[model samples]
Target: MIIDTKKLQKEVLENKKNHGFNTTDIEFELLRLYGETNELFEAWRKQDKENIDEELADVGIFLLGISEMLGSGLGEDITNKMKVNRKRIYKNRDK
Candidate 1:
């Protein structure tokens, strides 16, 4: 199935608002994302490739929620920046 990431992100934020997740809950989500990423890294280290993809997807979901809360389109912004940086940044760093 196709996913509309923007819509999904919006829904996440709306749900959080509706459920009244306070500042501490938001902070908890951020910490959860960090822990998920750590789990992904640990799975990678163990060469357990299967679970890593799911864990990383979990991280992406939380990150999208946080970014939406912050009024940011992180995926779009990052992709756009990478396009600009691909040539200049890599070339300069290689020098």
Candidate 2:
């Protein structure tokens, strides 16, 4: 099934609210992603690719959640930045 990231984020925040957690805030979500990325790095170092993938997904979910909460289109922003950087870094690498 295709997941609607915005709807899933809203649902997660609602569940957190029902449980007395303030997940509507972007900071909390960002901290969660930071922890998740650390875990993913650890798993990757241990050669646990499956767990790494799961943790990466968790990171992406939190990133999208925080971006939506903050009204930022981070996916597009990162893509545009990477495109410029790739051209500058890779296009002249042989020179």
Candidate 3:
């Protein structure tokens, strides 16, 4: 099934509220995102598909939460960034 990221983000925010998480602490979330990224790396290195998927989800959760805190539409931001990146030219290795 195709996941609805906006719905997921909304649920994440609601859960954070239910758990009494300090939603304003973007710094702490950034650190947590970093840890999740490292976990993803380790999972990839170990070839653990389950943990890899879990960590990847965690990374996305933290990122969406951060975007929520910043009042940004994560979906829109991603689309806009991708649009800009699509026009970029990479350096040739043989140059």
Candidate 4:
């Protein structure tokens, strides 16, 4: 099944608006994203599949929020950036 990321992003925006959240600080969003990433990592370390899934969702939520806050099309940006990443050859990624 294909997930409609654009639709998901729109839904996130709507949800935020419903909750009376106004996008004010990009720095706060960045910090939230960082915290969510660490939560994902912690879930992985604990081998908690359920928590991992939830953390993954949180990561996506923050990412989409950040994109919307920055007034960029999240879906388009992801597609374009991934295209470039897919073509790039990388070595020593772990180094």
Prediction RMSDs, each to the true structure? 3.6, 4.0, 2.4, 1.9
Model 3 regions more than 4 Å off: 1-3, 92-95
Writing each residue's lDDT as its tens digit, candidate 3 over 44-69 gives 99999999999999999998888878
RMSD score of candidate 2 (Å):
4.0
Show the colliding residue pairs in model 2: none
The digit string of per-residue lDDT tens for model 1 on 1-95 reads: 86677887888777767988642366788888899999999989988888988888878878888888777887687788898887673434543
Tens-digit lDDT track for model 2 on 13-51?
566668786556777777778899999999999999899
Q: Rate the local accuracy (lDDT) of all candidates.
A: 0.79, 0.75, 0.87, 0.87
State candidate 4's TM-score: 0.83
Listed per model in order, the count of residue pairs whose N, CA or C atoms clash below 3 Å is 0, 0, 0, 0
Q: Better model by lDDT, 1 or 3?
A: 3
True-vs-predicted CA distance for residue 72, candidate 3, Å: 0.6
- Candidate 4: residue 50 lDDT (0-100): 100
TM-score of each: 0.69, 0.66, 0.87, 0.83
TM-score ranking from best to worst?
A: 3, 4, 1, 2
Query: Could you tell me the TM-score of candidate 3?
Result: 0.87
Candidate 1: the clashing residue pairs are none
